[model samples]
Target: MIDINSWPLYVQLAFGLGPFVIGFSGGGILVFTTLRHYDRIVSSFPNSRGVQNVLRIFANYGFHPRSMQVAAIAGIVLFPRMCIRRGELEPEEVRNFPPEIKRLMVIFTTLLGVGLAWVALAVVLLKLSGGN
Candidate 1:
């Protein structure tokens, strides 16, 4: 068997932590964007009891706001697109999404992007910082 220890430190770090970092960061972005989108829709339809109830249901699932946001997003991403495509949400509901939610989505996406970028940076830093 080849000796992994003989490989460069940067390579080792990248091989070791890259998958976890990328998976976590990408998932985070997807989750944050989904939650923020749903939040905006719920906020716009303040009179809609169903929307309000859905939002509350989402909130009860976790301690961190991020966790709720992520779970909402994962549902959107993983569920059948056809289900949402059917006129479940009104046009006004889509149009009335809050500006803050969009801004937060951008922020969350940026943070995840930065996190993915860091995977490489971390490998280089670890190598320079001296592991092999």
Candidate 2:
């Protein structure tokens, strides 16, 4: 792998800062746009229990204002099969979910995944390069 430390200052700044701006913009879409459709998400899977519990717990604890949003995202992303197995969402329901919502989730997930991988790669590169 190429050593990022050896790269010019501008290249290193772009490599490190580009994803930060992109990630936040994508997250803003999720918070402002995607979250507007949250009722649609709940209505699609009215049997949701686990996700509700997560929301409730966050509420009870008085977590961040967007904690429920984050939890719902986590439920959908992290424990999808568990949600299905627990009857929070049925197979048919999942299959019939709105295409736009799925697209949004896919975009959010892909961005988040790629951002994390990029950061991890940077960490490894810096470690290998014997950090400046």
Candidate 3:
């Protein structure tokens, strides 16, 4: 078996921290986007009680799916630099993505986590079984 303990400190550190860094960064952005989405929803339809109620129900029921998408988007953007290059957001402007887009991000983020885990598990299993 390949000796992980023999690997350089940096390689070990990368293996240990890479997934977590991605997960934490992606998760943070997911939460941030969700909050911004909520704010937009509240501000955009403050006068509509029915719409607000409906949205509230959806939010409560749809958290997981929404979180997944946000994570995926965070992975893609990683930082605002991509957005700046694409002209999606100005340096001075706050992100106020629409609710629909926010919903999509949540779902994607959740799926991204699942996919990452699956691949990681597969690699570990293959290594353990002496498969290249």
Candidate 4:
């Protein structure tokens, strides 16, 4: 197998730092957007059973409902920007998203971003450790 130690220090640092940066920054954006969207929904429909059900599901997954709610809102706010950057979505699509579904999307995207960052960090650390 090829020796990772032979690689330059910049490469190693990039491998180490890239994921953490993406995870923390991207995750923060997602969490912020999701919470804002949730607040909007709650304000508009205080008696929304659907919202309660959604929160219940998040709680079942071992998340604090309030924190998850905020993350969900952040994710919603960040997704359009992400999708546009990736060329997977257009500005028009953002305008067409229903408020409730937008909140759900945020939650999904935030979790996905966090998971990706964790995985990237793991790979980088493994490489740095010379584990192959």
Candidate 5:
């Protein structure tokens, strides 16, 4: 059990924000990917409007903003153990995603950083203003 109180302020702040960052990263990818492949994703589901609506709702909120945070925590706990037991990824294995997908990833990463900073600034301003 690490002593958080003994840690520097920056480290304490990072510990607080780390989950937000991870969740945002995951949520950003989910949002960008879903929007980019909206047609293809929707087409794969049933043609019924009712089913489609349900799926749409799920797609919109299933990977909602904080979902990525949960996923990040799960991955932190599960991925490393899986990797150690299964061995590392092969050197020859590579993701040959389409150019558009690559572009979306780059765009989303930039947007996520900007968004996080913006949100942080807004929160600080709100607090400074005493929630007025």
Candidate 6:
């Protein structure tokens, strides 16, 4: 272990907060993009349970912007296969997906993975240090 306890206070603070910062920033951008592009995306994933449920929830919420954003991010990121894979997502739709949406998906997934990994590392560091 790298002995995170021995690190400077500022450095420790940075490590503690970095994942949250990335999660919030990336989440905000992803939500906004999803909000802006929901129409373009919804049609493509008609059979995806995650997408359908989220959209239903988003609709039942009276089309609230924040709800829609949360729905889109959760729908797309959590069940990526529902939107990307051949059996889960329609082949034609996947093939015809817009470039911008693809880029957004990549960015969203990467940000989520990075944020989770960062938090996992922090936990592992602490565990290895015997909660010191």
Quick one: best TM-score, which candidate?
2
- The deviation in Å at residue 74 for candidate 5 is 16
What is the TM-score of each predicted model, taking all chains together? 0.42, 0.74, 0.43, 0.49, 0.37, 0.70
TM-score of 2: 0.74
lDDT of 6 by residue, 1-132 (tens): 567789999999999999988877677667766667767777766665555666666565344654455446544654566456534445555556677777776776677679899999999998887775
Q: Candidate 4 local accuracy as lDDT? A: 0.55
Clashing pairs in 1: none
Model 3, span 17-106: residue lDDT tens: 666766665566566666656445345434434334444444544667455433433443335566566654344432453546545455
lDDT per residue, candidate 4, 1-132, as tens digits? Answer: 445566799986776666677566656655555555545543432333444444655764332566576554334345446645655444554565566656555555655676696777667767766786
lDDT of 3 at 97: 37
lDDT (Cα atoms) of all candidates against the true structure: 0.54, 0.65, 0.54, 0.55, 0.46, 0.68
Runs with alpha carbons beyond 4 Å of true place in candidate 1: 1-7, 23-41, 45-66, 73-84, 103-132
Better of 3 and 4 by lDDT: 4
Query: What's the candidate order when arranged by decreasing TM-score?
Result: 2, 6, 4, 3, 1, 5
Let me know the TM-score candidate 3 reaches against the reference structure: 0.43
Write model 1 residue lDDT over 1-132, tens digit each, in one string: 345467899997776776567657666665656554654434565543444445666666443654554444333323324434664434454345565655554555555666666767656655775655
lDDT for each residue of candidate 5 in 70-112, tens digit (9 for 90 to 100): 2232232223344334443211111222435445545555556
What's the lDDT for residue 105 in model 6? 67
Give the clashing residue pairs of candidate 2, or none. Answer: none
What is the Cα root-mean-square deviation between model 6 and the actual structure?
Answer: 3.8
Candidate 6 or 1, higher TM-score: 6
Q: Stretches of candidate 2 above 4 Å error?
A: 60-67, 70-79
Clashing pairs in 5: 23-68, 23-69
lDDT per residue for candidate 2 within 79-129, as digits (tens), equals 479778777656676676787777777776667667777878778878887
As a whole number from 0 to 100, the lDDT of residue 97 in candidate 6 is 66
Query: Could you tell me which residue pairs clash in candidate 6?
Result: none
lDDT of 1: 0.54
